[model samples]
Target: MKTDTIKRVLGYTAPYRLNLIAGFVCALLYVLFTLLGPVLIGRAIDQVFGPGNVNYQGVVFYLALLAVTVLLAAAFQWVLNVCTRNVSAWAANDLRRDAFAVLNRVPLKYIDGHSHGDIISRMVNDAELVAEGLLQGLTQLLPGVATILGTLCVMAVLNPFIALVVVLVTPVSIWFAGFVARRTDGFFRAQSAAQGKLSGYINEMVAGQSIVRSFGYEQRCFEEFDKISDELYETGLKSVFYSSITNPGTRFVNAIVYAAVAVFGALSAISGSISVGQLSCFLTYANQYTKPFNEVTGVLTQMQTALASAERLFAVLDAEPETPDAPDALEPKKCEGAVRVENVAFSYTPKVPLIENFHLDVKPGQRIAIVGPTGCGKTTLINLLMRFYDVREGAIYVDGNEIRTLKRNALRGMYGMVLQETWLKNATVRENIAYGKPDATLEEITAAAKAAYAHGFIKRLPQGYDTMIEPGGGNLSAGQKQLLCIARIMLCQPEMLILDEATSSIDTRTEMLIQQAFEKLIQGRTSFVVAHRLSTIQSADVILVMNAGRIVEQGTHASLLEKGGFYANLYNSQFAVE
Candidate 1:
């Protein structure tokens, strides 16, 4: 693991440090009591035939001591498990929460640039991996270390020659495990990344399954999925194979340490320097000393996986958040809705300029209709006005004050937007309608829904306004969803309105009704209407025709037609086709 990643992963445990400390203490006591079992058994062995007689009482007493040690060890081990489990669960929970918060705080550009599924994988799958790994580390590692150290102390005091032999052979186990760990580390990282990509691809396919079947893309989609799945398989197999070797490799080394102790210990016993029971204790101690190495190496795979996942999680946590509001930002209670765009320039990418030298001036309460072919900066202008993307040059002003100086939330609160893409939460029809004003009463919600001509359909549902809606309004028709969105904006009654192809999904008859509803909704409010059907906006007080990121013409419907300029050509072409 990288040093930085290790520090960061450990940081999550800092908040639960007390639990970790308690776990460590329990592990220490557990190991101490466990080591006592061997010593007491050795004593009992000596007592069985003490002084050429069967010392039954002495053996029974030591056996009782052995039982006590076993019970104590198990008790401490239980406490240790509880502490470690709590620490792991809490740490993982905090890590996941922080990852989610980062997603919300990051800029929309970041969201657009990354895969949504990949982000979700980092938050869910990767976090669980870290928790599992942490749990294994705590459960095995702390006790394993304590057992190894405690065994060494007992072994050295009982017989230093055998202890020397055990110590000399221990390094071989450590070195072997370390070598295998280094080799498997890269494969583990690759495996984690491949898993994320596979998850992303699966999410995209499942969410858009309808489009896939409609276009007969199942075969191609499966091929793509197979490719990603195969990559994950290859990396996973290699990492597991390499890490799997560490356990057996250390076990082989441990067997050597045990054999050497047996050989040397028996010689001392025969030489009358040590009792048979002492020799038996030395053999057990040698095995105990090497057990930790075997157990630690056994869990190496999980630890490597955890480290890989931690790196992925940290990548998201380290992402830069959206730009902060200006220190002296204004929070206007009400905006007059007068907007001006002065010599603005912007592009999603540095190399491709999408909007350049754009200028517009609109007085408060004027209904400005924007019309252009697709990709002519109509939506881009709206995005700029909402500060979704700030201008690269010049400035935008609302009510004669530069918008950059305004708080983002306050500025956005002043405008009611209804995009062509309708989004609804998993909530009741009433709750969805009152989304803009959460505290709205039923009467107010009904009034807004009635204005959008949605009240009739809503009343026809099984539960009327209380009917539950599925996510993305999947249970509702496209037009029904759009109507709910219009009702949402109507409830807000913002100072300004932005309707971007808002009624595109409705039928002609419903569109006429909505247009009438919008006439009342937009009255006395500064509304910017982006319409492709030119007839709907003929009554607009002013029409701004855009082309290639610039306003090519602007005038009233009659005056623009008389000019026979770009606006006239566009209006004539659209109507002629209709």
Candidate 2:
């Protein structure tokens, strides 16, 4: 097990260390106040029942002192809780922010292999667990330890013989806690992993509901979901079972020790070896001692669960992200939208290249179309252009400078992209349209929406531009969502545009509207159009037909048909279908 994971968790609390220290000091003071109760009880016992005058005034005074002590302890506890809660909440927020920032920088490869549910679990559940650990662990450490130590010292001072018995039981309680913690930790880790799997299953099922229903796989999906849920249930039960054993077992052992201590103290008091007051104090201290031991056992068990979550969270945080920009990389200067790919080769995996020695030269304000069957590296080409993934070999240049030498942000900021699967957050229509340019005014957003042919329908909606979209834009039709995405891209006013099957899912009427919008958006920008619909790109200045990761044909529509190659065959097939 990596200890560093726990250390990193502690580091998040460094910013709030002063508050933690204040909380600790208050916890110690609270413990001191707690000790006063038993001391006052002992004094009352001596004055009222022992060989001493029954002084009512002293009794009243001690009672008043006891009440004051209780109030002060409560005050200290309240202050300690406030400090710890504030600090822990802040720490959790900071951890979440850092985790999200790291996730944004992680390579597409990492995201491709991980489910959204699993990633979300780390950000939500794991971060909350770490927060709980920070608050409860820090608050409990001082009070729990000080209570135990104060009780022990008072017991030893009041009567050494009984203190010896309490001391002997201490190690045995600790040992039991450790043994149970080890067992519970394994179960908790298994539970956390199972929870992730269950969450992933649910996310996939919801996202693919259409396919599932179309294929009549509802029963199969339920069966698979049930299997995951059952596994999670079993793992959760095991963790609960392991944790349950610690508290009862510790209490049982402490009960036996308590009985022995009571018997010994009674005999000593009767033999006149120790005063009744001292014996009473010893019993009070004995309960205090065993109380914290029991409490510690529970806290330790919880800590095991917390540590398990921390381990999983740190695993994600520690993962090496994709190659970062070089320290010497400079932000690219404004440039004409020219692009060049020189002998560029790329791959998702090292064993299989997606694009091999690909070469292309696009002049400023030129339009290029890329046509290929599904999964023939068409979208991969766009990904490389945006630096979502770096080329494995050769170089790509934007304007006249190598893309790698430009800061990734600067390189990507030059282009606007509209993907086939439009993503819209649950925000107002105006907010979604202005996503790329957050500071865009209402007039600017309206103009962009009008250009994308979305403004008319948007105005007809109940709340118009202020209407809140459902998750993934489920409130709108597929065409409407695509239009909103186009509007968002238009608002950015990028110098270059990438249309990755942006109109593939829309009807002919909607496609015509979008095509008009595309014409306006791409008028003076270098554009890359990746489409299966030959009609959409028939008028391109240059068309490249990719097959099996290489460009097998290149030309304008008329030129490509004269060559009688891949592009020619593709164009003929579409015409034949029409």
Q: C-alpha displacement of 273 in model 2, angstroms?
A: 3.1
lDDT of 1 by residue, 1-578 (tens): 46788788879999998999999999999999988888888888887665678778988999999899999999999999999989988998999999999888887788889888898899999999999998988899889999988998888888888888888988999999989998899999999999999989998998788899999999999999999999999999999998999999999999999999999999999998888888888888888888888877888899899999999999999899878898999999878989999999999999998889988999999999999899999998999999887889999999988988999999899999999989999999999999989999999999999999999999999899999998768789999999999999988899999999999999899899999999998889899999999999999988999998988899899999999999888878876853
- Clashing residue pairs in candidate 1 are none
My TM-score estimates for the predictions, one after another, are 0.95, 0.95
Off by over 4 Å in 1: 50-53
Candidate 2 C-alpha lDDT tens digits along 198-244:
88888888988999999999999999999999999998898988888
Q: What is the C-alpha local distance difference test score of each model?
A: 0.91, 0.86
